[model samples]
Target chain A: MTTASAEPLLSLRNVEVVYDNVSLAVSGVSLDVPEGQLIALLGANGAGKSTTLRSISGLLQAARGKVTRGEIRYAGQLVNTLSPQDRVKLGIVQVLEGRHVFEQLTTNENLEAACPVEMSRAEMRSALDRAYTFFPRLAERRNATSGYLSGGEQQMLAIARALMTRPRMLMLDEPSLGLSPMLTTEIFSIIRRINREEGISVLLVEQNAFAALDLVSHGYLIESGRVVMHDTATAMKNNPDIQEFYLGGHGVNFRDIKHYRRRKRWLT
Target chain B: MDWILFLELAANGAVTGLLYAMVAISIVLIFKSSAVPNLAQGALVMVGAYAVLAFSDWLGLPMWLAIPAAMVFMFGLGIGIERHALRRLAGQPIIMILMMTLGLDIFLRGITLAAFGGSARRMDLGISDDPLFVGQILMSRVHLTGAAVALMVFAALVLFFRTRRGIRLRAISNDYVASWSVGIGVEQGVALSWALAAVISTIAGVFWGAVQGVDQSLSLLLLKSLTVAVLGGLDSLPGAIVAGILLGVLESVVSGYLDPLVGGGSRELVVAVTLILTVLIRPHGLFGDRSVERI
Candidate 1:
């Protein structure tokens, strides 16, 4: 994807995040989401995937965490000093780790509040309609207090809220977390639909590798706060090491797999 | 009959409640956005009132000019305080934030004493304080006017929240980080909430000082407003208005009947009891959004 005079929509070059000036949360994580591309960040909990996303979007400040080193550029300009809200204006929006919808607001109000620019009544209504079309469940529960939404519904609301901002790039953290397989499928389809129809660049950080890899064209694996691997989704899916280490990667011989796990050099 | 006495106290309480609503709303606005409870809210009200004194009475500006100038000053002061003191302390423990506000209260009070002195200062907004009788119920026109102003402010606030900026306020209050990523300008939102609260406090302080007379005792208004805020739910704007009025009535009624039966000065005791009871029963405040669990 690297071509002269063409820049990735979102680029992180060796970004490092340190909390409380000491503990490193993310380090040397360099990757890109080219415009019109959907990229997957695959990692387990504590792999600093969320930190990378946070550093990119500037939420690190809220948690007393700072990006100590490296650069994050959006649309070919340095945005490391920009506030989170400024990044949103640049269309760099992040749906945080949990489904962090405004619990106190109605689903409709949640979307209305996320609007990036002031619009007339008719304009705002059409904007909301577009969001509702993305998740019809949200339309059904538009006025329901979001705190009462089912976990899956809340996740949809979070995405819907992010969409209301008119994001050029949507960075979502763990959209499939705590969702049942059926609901997970429903959400992933909507996400895929959003990408296909809207052309919003996606940087999806997920522990649910199976669901995300299916939707993404490219993938990066992060481990211990560092990028461990990168490939096209198809190549990563068939890669022997990834399947054995992740993706329930085991042969039918359970004892052999257990012995293989014991002897695994990476585990040590 | 005692029934007449009850009606009188109730009417009186409601009037006072409206004025308290001003203080309550200011506290609620800051608390909703910043979650610090703005211990200096009452002090801000005191400063706002004293600003009017400095503007009109001291500087010899007309009442009309003095009022707007004071409000503008208070708004800037609020923004400055948030940007200067509170911004640096972001992500601190809630206790630390609260104590910082307490320090602000002290600092403001010291400044007020130095500027205006400890003696009570009086200023009127040209509203008559004459008694108006309704079926043997006596009402002060000054207070009735204050109630009208409070209602207008409350209505204006309700309308403001319905606007784009207001929605952003609610969003910031609900989730600062989420609001930030949606282009809501969290720092500016925090500063604006403080500035908005300060503007409200100026209005409240002007009315309050006009009626109660300006003194160090004005700072005590914070405690009563905080009670209203807690009763209403610190994050709920409507909650502050409703709880403020309710607490005002409760205080007036308790002090009128219950205080005399015991001795005197039952207002503070009643407020304390009500706040404790409300905490035990509905810790989230009456209008506060329920912290529902979805396990």
Candidate 2:
């Protein structure tokens, strides 16, 4: 993270997204994930975190969403206009907010499905081995139908499937959403290893602020469609506003922060 | 009881059942890949038969050349339709897309009627009209050949899903956005699915036309396949085949024996009752996935 390169791996400058032509989802949210860095994007529900990840991966367009403004750069190239498939080929893959693993497909088949059709058999075999190595639990149930997997296992399969794509930068939304506390800790440890051992850059979006802060060194906090805070995870954790508001702090100023309502619709 | 006649009718039922399932499989293929209900499937079959007629009966090409040419033509037509018409309508409501295909069905049926006229057309696949017998029962070569083809297609489909391309198709079917996130060309997958569905329909057309003779009624046969699709599960390939053959056998046996006592054409009733029973028993279809993902 402290490599201090002139350009970050991914940089979003004043980005704005709107869905269904009229509903303003988010605006002016900007951050950068440096090479080999684990960066967290923290926000509550409807805080536009998932929309930002989807926008970066071009899934917004697929869902009738458009990035009407701002620059999204991935691997130092402007990528707001790219298709989701093309963005993936350029080494950015998003594990969508929910565990969107193909439920009908078997777990092993799902991994193979994520691979490009052009992948060689040997290469695919190794990719499967790598994924299985990352989550031994997934390896145990490799042939089971994904619909039958437990919530935590389904989340693991989703990330393992994304990993099978061999992405350079992995963006995960709500990795700990429905997982048990122990399972969440276990999953985050593997994520850390994936980032550290494999050197894959991570951009994690989560509603679980404490868990996200524990893993990522740098963080961006957006509330109501705009970036309200950006700092190192340490700074974010110690900040009084984030502590009193997000870190389960007591309710002396709860009513006042609720009215911090900056309805900054950026795409207009 | 005239048990020999009953056995022969049962054999005929099996053949007809496979053909009916063939059309259902085509429906399932398109529906599974893109969630687009291809209401034009039967019309596609009719058009395919007409193409074979144009190539063989009109142009005097042999069966060898005529069949492949018609299939390739249908494949291109399918991809072309997807590219020009359905591609732009991506993310539209399912009902809207389904209606568009219904429109396509009428349009294609009208075109076939204009192009080939309302007269019946026959295709000589050279499979011969001779009846093959086992023990006391007799089976037509045409039905057996068509059934064999259907079985082979089923096998090929299983093998296809096991291959990387097939797995990707399944992935796309399972989750379109998720598939795209992992580097799949969703548009291309949808188009390819249409093309495959077209090819299957054309083969069914060729076989059905060979038996029933290509005419306006060939397109209406989609009603039967639709019945099979719903009875089997629109998204289940194996379910389609099983339902197709089951309905076919039921129709054959009932019309053969029960119809004489009941005074004609209760096969439709039997199919309706069976479909109702299937719905009551397994609403998701015999082999369909239990529930699609909500999110």
In candidate 1, position A46 carries an lDDT of 96
Calculate each model's fnat, 2 decimals: 0.85, 0.90
**Candidate 2 DockQ category?**
high
The regions of model 2 sitting more than 4 angstroms off are A1-4, A251-268, B272-282, B292-295
lDDT of 1 by residue, B1-295 (tens): 6888899999999889989888998988887787877889889999999999899978899999998999999999999999999998888777888899999999999999998899998977898877899899998888888888988998998999888788788888888878876777788888998998999899988989998899898999988888898899877878888887899899998899877688987888988898898878988889976651110
Each candidate's lDDT (Cα)?
0.87, 0.87
Q: How well does candidate 1 score on lDDT at residue A140? A: 99
Q: What C-alpha lDDT, on a 0 to 100 scale, does residue B205 get in candidate 2?
A: 92
Best by DockQ: 2
Give one digit per residue, the lDDT tens place, for model 2 in A1-268: 3433668999999999999989888988889999889999998899999999999988898778999999999877899998888888888999987889899899999999999767899999999999999999999999999989999999999999999888989999999988899999999999999999899999999988989999999999987788888899999999876776678777756465654443223312
* The 10-residue segment with the lowest total lDDT in model 1 chain B: B286-295
| CA deviation > 4 Å runs, candidate 1 | A1-5, A118-126, A249-268, B290-295
DockQ in order:
0.76, 0.82
lDDT of 2 by residue, B53-148 (tens): 788877888888988899999999999989987887787777788889999999999998898889987767888898788787888888889999
Distance from true position, residue B124, model 1, in Å? 1.9
